[model samples]
Target: MTGPRIALFAEGGDWHAARLGESFAARGAALVRLSLDRAMLATGTETGVELPGFDDGLPDAVLVKTVAAGSFEAITLRLGILHALRDLGVPVWNDARAIERCVDKAATSFHLARAGLPTPATWTTEDREAACRIVARECGQGPLVLKPLFGSQGRGLLLVERPEDLPPPEATGGVHYLQRLVRSPAGLFEDYRLFVVAGRVVAAMARRGATWITNVKQGGEPLPFTPDARMTRLAVAAAGAVGADYCGVDLIRDEAGRALVLEVNSMPAWAGLQSVTPVDIAAAIADGLLAALPQRRQLAAAGG
Candidate 1:
């Protein structure tokens, strides 16, 4: 008998997809690679959503590995496919709503703050004048970090020491997302990346670099580190704040030793974390996704 089929949404030649495929196979499941751009909505089909290679029916579950960069309409359509799948009773790991909240840094910050979580002071606006005022007022305390609202991997970051340092709106995708820069004591550049799965911190690493940006993709070195109880609690809370089934919670400490959440990534990459840890990150994620399957949950509830 064939095992449950899982649809993995990722681009071609993705290393993470390959790892997940292997992990799922080890657990008596088949992982079929699919692209979100190719997912279609058809009225006359058995499943209103027409995913490539799932001609007879929808996959047992959908795992969102990556959502490629595209125009606003294109991205919306891609997310719409995830939404459609969930409405069809197919489990979508980290579903559309969670993706949206984490993709937009402003939204993530809002949710974190609303939950009373300790996060960096942030302000996002489209009005250049208001942004300038925020910069002028906040810069006196320290430098403000200008980040692209819809970006990741430590890209497109700038330290704004003055209002004049603010770029034109056209250069910033028509929005200014600024946060007060949080630095470690004595100019140390380091932060923690905690991998949370099933409401627990399974593994973690310390990213250290010469500059303020400590992302592994940006030349930071990843080192194995066990998270303390406070870090574990903060990371789990950050993930819950954004409603993610699994996530990578970025945490850093201020000079006064208060832990602050830097960001919560819904669709985070774990290659660097995997390299330093022996927890089999990919298998953990596959386990988390499969355990959340609707059929599995129903069976468990029925004592199967």
Candidate 2:
């Protein structure tokens, strides 16, 4: 049996690409790490190289990561590339449209809230005065988490314990997404990143930190944790809400001892989850990708 060829995208993701590749390779699948960032634009040339450094041909699927904002032309060009890949019938992880929504914290929050899933109580306003007022009122004693409309890896998050402590509104387009802070136990300033692949929670683990932030990139430690039925259900629900077959749902316990989703990463990095949990998250991802392939369409069309 030949292995399914996988292409992992973007730069600085070589480690994860390697992890997933190794996981799939161990399972008899050939995984290829293609750093899309290697396709650098030159001073005058157009149509930068594709499939560089390898002669393995286009992949059966690709796991996308890292997107940089650029001028209108660049934005359109990048998006056109994504759409073109999907049009070519290659399976892209996090799915294509899912990437568009999950990258924006504000938009994802709105969509999750609309689906009646539990998310942090949030108020987004370009009106600085209004944003400040809400944070002042709702976050009286507990901390308030101020997030960039587009943030990841727990970066650009502000733990505004006081109203006067927040940055000036003009700093972030005069708008803010303020959520009521939820604190974990004293010993564990941790949260769970529920790994969902193919609408199921493949792995569940907690992160412990000294502060409210608990991302591995933020010096937090990943620890093993079990997913109760509630966590499983909600995590799956959150993924479905975001229209992603693969994602990481960030869950924190609220005052009521219930899990409340804080954020959903459409293109979630599973290095931590893979490390802590016994599940082969990469294989789950590969399985999901294979299941979503166009071959299913052909089989259905032929009445197989």
Candidate 3:
């Protein structure tokens, strides 16, 4: 079989993109790395999609590494392009639907709960009074973690220890997403980031945080972790719940030592997780994506 051509969507010339390009090249797959901002979409075109340096045609599949922040319209258009590509029968690993669901914290929580996965109690509301009520109730029990509805890398996160410390809904960009803070019995702030690919846990690592937030981007240190059955099962289930072809599932253990799903990232970065784990994550991802191309073609042939 001919090697499948792949389109890697990310911020151009970044470390992750460059590394992925090298991995794909080593696997004998052609890769076209371009930003979503550069992919043109139109109504009257052959494929209705025009990516930079792909004058021949679209690739066999698309791998989304990063979807840059943009205005509402810009973001919508970029997602629309991915949607269009899927409608045209090209496989989009972690397609637009999964990306949209994972990007919205509220949606991710709902899906996890629907799949019977344990997640922190979360409340989101546009009404300031209603949001404040949630904060008061949660604070009465324990500290609350206020997070942006659409964010990652632990940015814009706030710990509401006191009811009076709660910010208004407007401060949360017109929506308050609060979760009950889960404490570790040992009083150490840590969590597990399990990287799942194609419904399997490819690699995992424990993150030790300087404070309550254990995200690597928040100054946490990554340590090698051998995932137990429970952790691996929960991570895989969470990824399936979010409809991700590949993802990073964050698992935090509460005071009772029972793990709870924290978040599922559809376009997860593996640099930190790679440092501690011996797994060549880039190669694994490349193999999974390449394997998917043949399966996609077979499905199309079978009218699936």
Candidate 4:
């Protein structure tokens, strides 16, 4: 019998892809690296998607490491392919629905709020005047962080301290996502990233930035952190809220010392976390993906 074949959806030559490949290899699994941008969808009497390199057949499961950046239509179509694969009874880890919910900051916040998770107050609107009012009203009390509705790694983030400082609606591309910037009680510009796999907090790290944005890609330094019960519960709940099989849940401390969720990422890069943490996250994720294959396939086949 052949080992479970997995299609890794990530850009070629990415370090993450190499690491994941090694982990899967150790587990006696075969991984085919393919870029979603290069993958095409074919529909007919029998609908299926095709990757340029995976001509043999569709894999048993797809492990999504990254979703490439593209125009709205392109991104949607890429996610649609993942959706198609899931519909065809192939297990897609962090399935299309989960990716959609997490990629869109507004949707993630809504889900977090709905679940009564400790997330910062947030507002998303397309109306310029409405956004201005929201910024003006909220900024007077404290700073509000303006961010792209669909982005990661803390890019394109602005901390608006004054109403007049708010970018015009046209500048924001007609949509605005604003969240209250929670200040740490200790006055440190830091946050915790809890890496969760299969509903457990597998590893964690504290990221302290020179300023407010604490993303590792943004020059933040990562340090190993021990997870407390509260942190574990909040991170796990946030992941569940976004329906992610594995994810990175960012949390910050408020002035009153309460932990609040900042964001949840379905397709998270863990190099920074791995550097400071001792856990073999890649191995854990690989094991989880393999373990989920049989059950996920069963669920998909049963119309679940």
Candidate 5:
């Protein structure tokens, strides 16, 4: 049962990291678990490989579960190894570019808009006055959401309806990541996370929350979501917009029953989604990336 090797990039403390390793191990695929934080410093990115003590050989596929974005050395070094492994023909889930793009919410929104995907009315600006005006126009007289451009688990998010409600711009480096508060027609404002793997929708769940913030980390509860044709279409389009091989696209239904992409997560958390849906998301990802490698090779072979 020696299947292709798959590496899971996540901190040991994360349960998903352990669960993923266990899942692949049950299938006899060699699983390497490494935390982005533990990777070596920015000694260079050309062929960045090796930390002080970890060397698990180049894996056939890499699943990035968690990233330490702060420490420049940590993020850059891990990205280096992942990118290097990619160049060596090992499929890195999300790849370095996709990961980089999705990790930055601003960039993800930009790409989604460029791809003609329906995204929320978003306004990001350094000028607070202009941003405030946009928010008032869209969200109606304040109570706008100010999310950090680069944050996970709904951290550092602001719901401001007044100037006093607005924190010092310097508090978050003077960058305002604002979005119009869009409410779903459904009384609960349910949001769906469509888990796309191997270029197909594997499983999905609707997150029902009390507020506009529907992040599971922020008390959103998951429910089985059987995507309709429209839901499936939006999920696939959202994934394509960001070029993520495996992704979790957040979608919300507007009044017109139109599904608008809320966000595209490259390294999306699946434990919660899996708990609600009868699907082995991590294993699906591991298997999908493994399958893609050979197809990629065939494509490279056909010169004509």
Candidate 6:
């Protein structure tokens, strides 16, 4: 008998996809690659959905590896497909709702604050004048980090130390997303990325950077680090705040040594985290997804 078939929503043959394929194969499951853009909603079909490679029926589960960047309508259509699969009894890891919360920095911060989780103070506004006023008011105390509301990989970030540093609305995609810059103690540039699976911190690493930005993609060095009790608790709580099945929770400490969550990524890349840890991160995620299948199927059967 054949084992379960899993769908991996991603683009191209990336390194992450390869690792996940090998891990799922080791566990006797077949991982089929599918792009969200190509999936469609066919009402007259047997399954009412036209997902590539699943013509006869739906897969046992789905792992959301990536949601490719697209126009507003295109992205919404892609997410709608994920929502449809979930409503039709297929388990989608980090489902559309979770993805939305994490993709929008403002939403993520709101959820974190609502859950009483510790995160840096943040603000978002579409009005250029309002953003300038905010920068003017806040810069006296400390610098503000301006970021694109819908961006990742530490791209398009600027340090606003003065009101003049605030750019025109056109330069910021018509919305200004700002956060109070978390200053490192004694000019030390460091942060932590903790990988959470099934509500547990499986692996973690300390990213030491040459500048204030500590993302590995921006030349930060990843070093193995075992999180302490407080860090583990905070990371786990941060993931829960956004309702992610699995995530990479970025954390940092203030001068007073209090840990704060920097960001919660619903579909976080783990190559850097994988390099320093021997826990086989991909296998852990696969195991987590497989372990939840029974319970998810039960809920679906019960019309949940």
Better of 3 and 4 by lDDT: 4
Give the higher-lDDT candidate: 1 or 3. Answer: 1
Report lDDT (Cα) of residue 259, candidate 4. Answer: 94
Give the Å shift of residue 25 in candidate 2: 3.9
The clash numbers for all candidates, in the given order, read 0, 0, 0, 0, 1, 0
Task: List runs of model 5 lying over 4 Å from the truth.
Answer: 37-48, 51-57, 136-143, 162-164, 299-304
Q: Please provide the root mean square deviation of candidate 4 (C-alpha atoms, Å).
A: 1.4
The segments of candidate 4 whose C-alpha lies over 4 angstroms from its true place after superposition are: 45-47
lDDT of each: 0.92, 0.74, 0.89, 0.90, 0.76, 0.92
User: In candidate 5, what are the lDDT values of residues 37-103, reduced to their tens digit?
Assistant: 6655344644355543335455666778777656776677777767766666666777888888898
**Ten-residue segment with the worst summed lDDT in candidate 3?**
162-171
Residue-level lDDT of model 4, residues 1-304, one tens digit each, is 9899899999859888898999999999989888889888987425578876667778888999998888989998999999998888888888999999999999999999999998999999998778788887888789999999987898889998766777877777788899998998778999999999999999999999989998999999999899789999999999999999999999999989899999999999999999998899999899888998888878877899
- All candidates: TM-score: 0.95, 0.82, 0.96, 0.96, 0.87, 0.98
Candidate 6 lDDT over residue span 1-304, tens digit each? 9999999998998899999999999999999998888899889987778888987789999999999988999999999988998999999998998999999999999999999988899989998888889988888889999999988888888999987888788888899999999987778899999999999999999999999988899889999999899999999998899989999999998988889998999999999989999999999999999999999999999999
Worst 10 residues of 1 by lDDT: 295-304
Between prediction 2 and prediction 3, the one with superior TM-score is 3
RMSD of 1: 2.4
lDDT of 3 at 71: 99
What's the CA error at residue 251 for candidate 3, in Å? Answer: 0.2
Evaluated against the true structure, the overall lDDT of model 4 is 0.90
lDDT-better candidate, 3 vs 6:
6
- CA shift of 9, model 5, Å: 1.4
Q: What is the lDDT of residue 14 in candidate 2?
A: 59
Higher-scoring candidate on lDDT, 3 or 5: 3
Model 4 residue 54 CA deviation (Å) reads 3.5
Write down the lDDT that model 6 would get. Answer: 0.92
Instruction: Sort the predicted structures by lDDT, highest score first.
Output: 6, 1, 4, 3, 5, 2
Candidate 6 regions off by >4 Å? Answer: none
Residue lDDT tens for model 1, 82-132: 988877777787789999999999999999999999999999999999999
